[model samples]
Each structure stands twice: as structure tokens, then as C-alpha cells.
Target: MSDYQVFIGGSAGSIAPVITILSSLPADFNLTITIVIHSGTDSKVSISEILANHSALTVIEIIDKEQFNPNTVYVAPSGYHLYVENKHHFSLSVDRKEYYSRPAINVTFSSAAEAFGEYCIAILLSGANEDGAEGLLKVKRHGGITIAQSPKSSQVDIMPQSAIDNRAANKILSPKEIISLLLEYNDLA
Candidate 1:
């Protein structure tokens, strides 16, 4: 099996696409999937539970130093930044927020790029800010695949548009198209 790790980042208008993507993946999906979505720091809701409702795969909020495993979905906790310490583990931080948001896309994406290198696949979805653009670029520079949701197909275009504008995306696709690509990759493993 491939050692690819998928890192998905999003903010406003991202939940629907995230649900759609996770729901489409089978329980035995071959890659480890990690997510970082901007959420209110004080909110008590669990994004992992919401994703669990849509996915057959195990979905849990990330704990510091937790090991990565295939066939599971890990959600970055609110009010913390998530990082891929290596292929086998994750680290969480309470540092200052980036782009005025904790669980910043850039933090996760850049760290995943560093940890996984060419085995990483980074996806940038609908959001209202430019937080993920530079990090996606870093992923691309590190030889990882970088995908951005097409602006026209997004609930809010700013985030994906920013990544496209910065030439960070290797592919610009609709949400369903992104799912298709993931399925194809899954099949290859």
C-alpha cells in the first residue's frame, strides 16, 4: 500500500464538501486522512462527530502525539494548531492563531508537507480567507499533490481562488471531481 497521507483544509462553507468527500470513501480506504477546519474557539460542538455521521471510517478529534493510521479520519481540534510530526504521529499546539483562526490550514498543510514530502496530498476547499494558499504552495514545492476546489463550484470562492491565484494548486476541481480523484488513488493502492 502507498504511504500517502491526505491533508484537507477548509474554513467557511467547507462542512458540506468535507462531508461529501468523507462519505464517499469506503471504510477500507488506503490512506490516512487528516483535516483542519476553522471553527469558533469557544464552540463545544465536535466536528469529528459530524464527520462520523457521514463516514464509515473511524473519525476522531486529534490528540497530541497520536499515531496516524489508515482507514481513519482525524479532525483537528478547535483552538489548536495541528501538525504532522512524522508519518507515524501528530502533534497539537496552543500557539497564537494564524489568519485569526486556530487550527489554521497553513499550519497543518505546511507541517504535513514537511513530514510526508512527496507522499502528501493536500486539498484546499471552500473558505472566506487566504490562509491556505501559501501552505499549498509549500506542499507543491515539496513534490506533493495539491488540489483546490474550483472557484465556480465552491460555496464561497475566495479560499480556493487564492490558492489558484498563487499557483499553488496542481489541479482545480469541483468537490465531486475531487472525490473521483481520491477514489482513483484509493484504487491504485
Candidate 2:
């Protein structure tokens, strides 16, 4: 029952700190990081590729009907929403979008709250929209730990600000400090 899921929010112009912090984390740890990065439908920065050159952890844009594993990273594909079913596997929904966003950040974090409950850790990083605010709140509602990038230090700040404004995130820090928090919590996990 040792499981952890983190939802990170940030734009391509904003997530280098996130990638750096997460990539430096131990690859064999019991936790799993699920990143919800923003990209235009045709944009080319592969989430896996960015992390591949940095993390020793296995990383992939999770596919439907795929089995879940720890010590790996799962990313939601560009056009589909990502969800979890009982923490055993992944699910994708392309029917509609939430928060005016396809592949919505809220959808992912809320679903994880259902699947992982208090074991989840939700993080909100830099971005231009308010996509992940309520979702991070949902995580907190279910007893999960919520961390937000300090809006003052974020490249975009809006995304993280929204979460903090909504009172969703419990702790706020810069990306480097977030890395320290993650390592501390990983030890706690």
C-alpha cells in the first residue's frame, strides 16, 4: 500500500526547475511521479525525452490499458485526460475536456485523490492558466499532501498562484526547494 502520485503543472517555458528537481530524485524509490505538462497539440517537447536525458527512472507517456509500476514516471498524452483506477492501472478519457482544457490538470489530480487518497502528493508548478487549482484542492480534501511552486518565483506564476489563492496547496517553495521537500517526503513515504 506504499504508493505516491504527484501532479506537476507548468509550461515549457517554466518547467526546467521541475524537471531538474524530479530527475535528481532516486530512480529506485517507492514513489511514482506523474507529470501533467502543458503542450500545444503539435508541439514537440517529449516529456520522456526531457526526463530521459536526466532521470534514471523509467519514463513514458502512459498509454491506455497499461499496467502501472513504481519507480517509473507516467505522463498524460497531449490530447487525452489521464486518470487512475484503484491505483492498479491507468485510464484515458477523450470524450470532453475540463477546466476549458483537454488533458486537464484538475481531472488528473482529482482522480488520483480517489485512487490514492492520502498517499498522494500533488504539486503545482508554473503555468499560465488556472487549470490545476481546484484539482490540487481536491487532493488536499482527500488528505494528500499538496505542494505549490512559489508564485513569486515561478516563470509564469499564474498556475501556482491560482492554487495558493484557492487555498489548495499547503506548502509553497521554489523549484530547488521543492526538490528538497520531495526528498524529505520520500524519506517519510
Candidate 3:
């Protein structure tokens, strides 16, 4: 299989959709998945654990300078910005928040677009702000595929809708539809 990476970003009301999509993916899915969601620094629950509960893929919080591995799910740690340093590794930063978010979707999406170029797939899910819009545009500019959750199907439409308005989305789909497309892309459907 080709070495493609998938980046998914979301905020308020996005956890359910993310879990739904992750749960639908098969265990052998070969692409690496990196996810960034708005999280409170004091939150007691681990997002990685939550994702692991829903996904057959190994899920872990990204560590600075860690190497990327396929079939694994990497979640951005709280209070830090996540970036793909290259196709093979990740880097974290303590930079000031963008859009009032530390692990901003824009940071991950833009960096992944640069690192993976055409081999990347960027997805924007439910959020209350316009964090991922410009990042999605960057991904599209770098020849990566950009997907946004359909506004009608989103819990909070601002994020995905912003991507649509920016003309960055190659496709707008619901969580279930996104899962089907992913499976089809990997020839698992």
C-alpha cells in the first residue's frame, strides 16, 4: 500500500463523530492517522485511551520527535502544538495558541501538508471556530486531499463550513460517508 497519512481536526461536539469514524475503520488499515482536538489542559480523561477504545488501531499520544508508524492513531497532546516534522516523524511546540487553541488544527494540517504533500489527506470535523479553514487551504494548495464534514451533519458547523466557504474541501461528507470513502481508498470495501 502507498504511504499516505491522514490528519483529522475537530473541536466542540466532534468526539462522537471521530469515534464513529475510527471504529468503522478495519484493523489492517495501513494509513497513519493523526488527530487534533480541542482539549482542556485539566481534563482528566486521556483522549488516546478514548480513541483506543473505539479503534482497532493502536492509539497513543504523540511524543516530540517520535517516528511515525502506519496503522497507528496519534493524538495531539494538550497544551502543545503538534506538527509533522517530516514524512517520518513528529515534533511538538510550546508556541502561543492560534485561534485560542494550543493543539490547533491549523498547525497540524499545515505542517502535514508540507511534509506529506500529495500523500496526505486532511479532514475538518465539527468545531465552534474557524481554526482548520486556512490549514485545509494549505493542504489543498500542496495537492493533498481535503475533506470537511458536511455542515448539515456536523454537531457544530462553523469549522467545516469555514473550509467549505474557503473552497478548500475536495469533499464534504458525514462521518459515516467519510468512513466509506476511507475504506474505499484503502480497498477494504
TM-score of each: 0.97, 0.92, 0.97
lDDT of 2 by residue, 107-157 (tens): 888888888889889888888888889989999999999988887778788
Top candidate, metric TM-score: 1
lDDT of 1 by residue, 118-163 (tens): 9899999999999999999999999999999999989999999999
Better TM-score candidate (2, 3) = 3
- Give per-model CA RMSD: 0.9, 1.7, 1.3
TM-score of predicted structure 1 = 0.97
Give candidate 1's error at residue 153 in angstroms.
1.1
Q: List the residue pairs that clash in candidate 1.
A: none
The lDDT, on a scale of 0 to 1, for candidate 1 is: 0.92
Model 1 clashes, total count: 0
| Winner by TM-score between candidate 2 and candidate 1 | 1
> Which segments of model 1 are wrong by more than 4 Å?
none
Please give the range of 10 consecutive residues that has the lowest summed lDDT in model 1. 40-49
For candidate 3, what is the lDDT?
Answer: 0.92
Model 2 ranges off by over 4 Å = none
